[model samples]
Target: MTMRTFASMAKPGVTSALPLKEIPGSYGLPLVDSLVDRFDYFVTEGAENFFKTRIQKYKSTVLRVNMPPGPPIVSDPRVIMLLDAKTFPTLFDLTKVDKRDVLTGAYMPSTDFTGGYRTAVYQDPSEKTHGKLKAFCFEVLKMSRPRIFPEFTKAFDELSVEVEKEFENEGKASFSDKVDDLIFNFLCRALIGADPVAPGPASLGNSGPTHLKTWLAPQLAPIASSGILPKVLDELTIHTITLPFALVSRDYKKLYDFVDTRGSALLDVAQNEMGLQRDEACHDLLFHIGFNAFGGMFILFPSIVKYIAKAGQDLQREIAKEVRGAVEANGGLNMKALESMPLLRSVVYEVLRMDPPVPLQYARARKDFMVESYDAQYEIKEGELLGGYQPLATKDSHVFANAEEFVPGRFLGEEGEKLLEYVLWSNGRETDESTVDNKQCAGKDIVPMVARLLVAHLFLRYDSFAVDESSSSAIFTQLTKAS
Candidate 1:
């Protein structure tokens, strides 16, 4: 529980150096070690197996592995990965580690996506700018909270019809692709206070939602396929490569224009009320609503639906009953009704624990610090990059019984409340509060509401559902209505 500092542990002026062993891990080769191997393992073995394999091999919760080197590419060549739930809390302590170094890790593009690091995601806790931006985000979310259920309900109705049409025509509906558009439109309506579609004619090509996805996919593609571009080239030309797309790509241009026009009122609130510049406010909105919130929802909603389907009919019936009862008792699918469903909350937490969209977290040590594992303590030096693989930590056998299996009501009661801290899927600990200085997700409170609404709508409309599990995609089929 206590941190052993060098000055405190050593005699004064002697500059005592504690023998810090590199957490046991294979760096592979010179320069290009383990990067491809790690990426392949993640994609093939799945995130759970990827971390489990390494933890078993190293026999330690902490490890140092060589990643594709550079600032904007990977955090560092020798990155430390923490796997134990006991050690997970250290990753959230911003007093010891600096999050601003590379919040997105090495794959984060060097484009001015935030209008010159003006967004809360890119700022350190100590910066005044972070506080202002954080306040702006919180205020916007407060205003939008009342609208989340209604907005998401509308989107889900549209999505349900779309799915039914596809199933009627083709015998199966690709829920993965359909959910992306559904969540994107829902997030836009709730967060940006704008319509999710472009203002112009349908003949003008793809809608605003399509354009937004087209632009974001390539930027995020590097994470799955590392080493796509050399570190040196990425450093020099990332902004050059990214900036021009906005100017040249018709889809990017249309998306940008639509967001700017539709989100002008929100931007003005940030500028006039919150003290941000017009352009900075616009860019921040895009980063917050488009990238952060949209990316998380895109993966989360589908995962929730897939798991519920996999959980079988009895559990699905229970969830549907809870949703129906809550709506009837409350007179509608409001935030209060969603919050009242303990079983739904447990299901969402379990889904996040098992398959977090963002499995890895990256931070840099601001100063020399000490971290302890289940067995031993290690000294981490300044500038060293640290990572926490969430799936492994959340599923630690020491914490959860039957760690690998999905239990639908695992977190339903007061006893389950204590286990909430182990849910590290949101880029921050469940116990951690979102603040200007901390790295907890700004949308942490809203994400659950969004997920609950999606679940409520799905169960309300369909009595039971089945998924096409043969492929990686989560397609829907065999939808049955209530008897």
Candidate 2:
């Protein structure tokens, strides 16, 4: 719908002139209300449901919500939750807002921690530095696709074997841990051009793919907790504790040293050709590939597997048939073969629609702007934190039919292609081209390719697998072998 159309649907009660602080919302108890309620909302209903609850209560798409303050967060009071699709696109338009200032906030990581904010994710599109970094990343990622397919194929092959062994041994296989390790290794290999596992003395304590998880846990713990104490600790310890460990810890040091030693030609190009300092180039690479791409897969892969398992036999069969046809048509399991599987691609899109791993996109208004919802327009002040809770927008009833259900072929045809704009979980709209100027994921195409490959490989290896989601972790059981 157009802006004017959405503005006309604006509800009558909440006016644009109302002071943002006075905006109706459950501010909760003195100190802990927002925190307690937020925790409860996520714990009981999941992160996707958190915005739905607020939208229902506030009766407006935009609401002032309290969130723990950190980097990319200016002041807690400025945080605004957006629950509609119409204005969500504004978040990615870098010209409308300054991503660097908004994301950096009060805590710019010391050069020792991240080498500096030269990474594309943190840089404003207008900056020459952003263009250099973005171009370098895109070039590296594009060239790495050939490497990515085979690496992912091998990883998933090993994972299938691991799952089969687990199920045979214990009658059930919890694939989450294995999925995490597999993606971590795949991403490291794709980005750094080396296995993540440390060698020799560095391998003594923390040797394998699990090293990223171990090294990141303590550092991310505070940020995840999200409160005054955690924020304070994060600021104090990021440089002192996190940076030092990132440099010296066996697991982390290997990655750091790899960039330093030109483990990948990308690293060499970034440092020598681009004229970026070694540490700066290393930090940028780590942030773009490690923090953004690897971190995304860490969550995305397992979620895809979970949904595919839950989809049951009929859907699995359809996927398998499509994948098999594509593989045969292409004569191999290459990029063309993977891209040719329409049903597999649809399933990935549907999974992303139902449960996007990264559900929220945050931005700060460089100037005052009016954002319209289905029923009303709200004035967002300069420097105010704007968050688009993507799960809500992607599933808006007006946009998708049977929005809550997992329609496997939802995006398979022409009508389905029209719904692409609603799927904004990848930091940019599906219609938007990935570019250095916008926040669109540089690995947008690659991420889905990886998901499609996972599905293809799983079905190729087994006829179908059943999921036991009765417990906290999903266990894929009843592996019917392909004849």
User: Per-candidate TM vs. native?
Assistant: 0.87, 0.84
lDDT values, one for every candidate = 0.72, 0.68
Give per-residue lDDT, candidate 1, residue 233. 48
Candidate that would win on TM-score: 1
What overall lDDT, based on C-alpha atoms, would model 1 receive against the true structure? 0.72
Off by over 4 Å in 2: 1-23, 26-46, 69-77, 101-112, 116-118, 197-208, 223-250, 262-264
What would the per-residue lDDT of candidate 1 be over residues 1-483, giving only the tens digit for each residue? 223344343233443344444568876774455555444344456455666777788878888764433323543456787888877767788878887746656445555434455466766787767777777788789878777777888888888888899999998888887887687777777877666564542221336567666667556544443334654443345422334344425665555565677777777888889897777666776778777888788888888889998899999999989988998999888767888789988999899988887877888888886776777667788888888877788888999999989998988788898888888876787767787667788888778767877888888888999998775668987788665
Q: lDDT, candidate 1, residue 335?
A: 67
Tell me the lDDT of model 2 at 187.
71
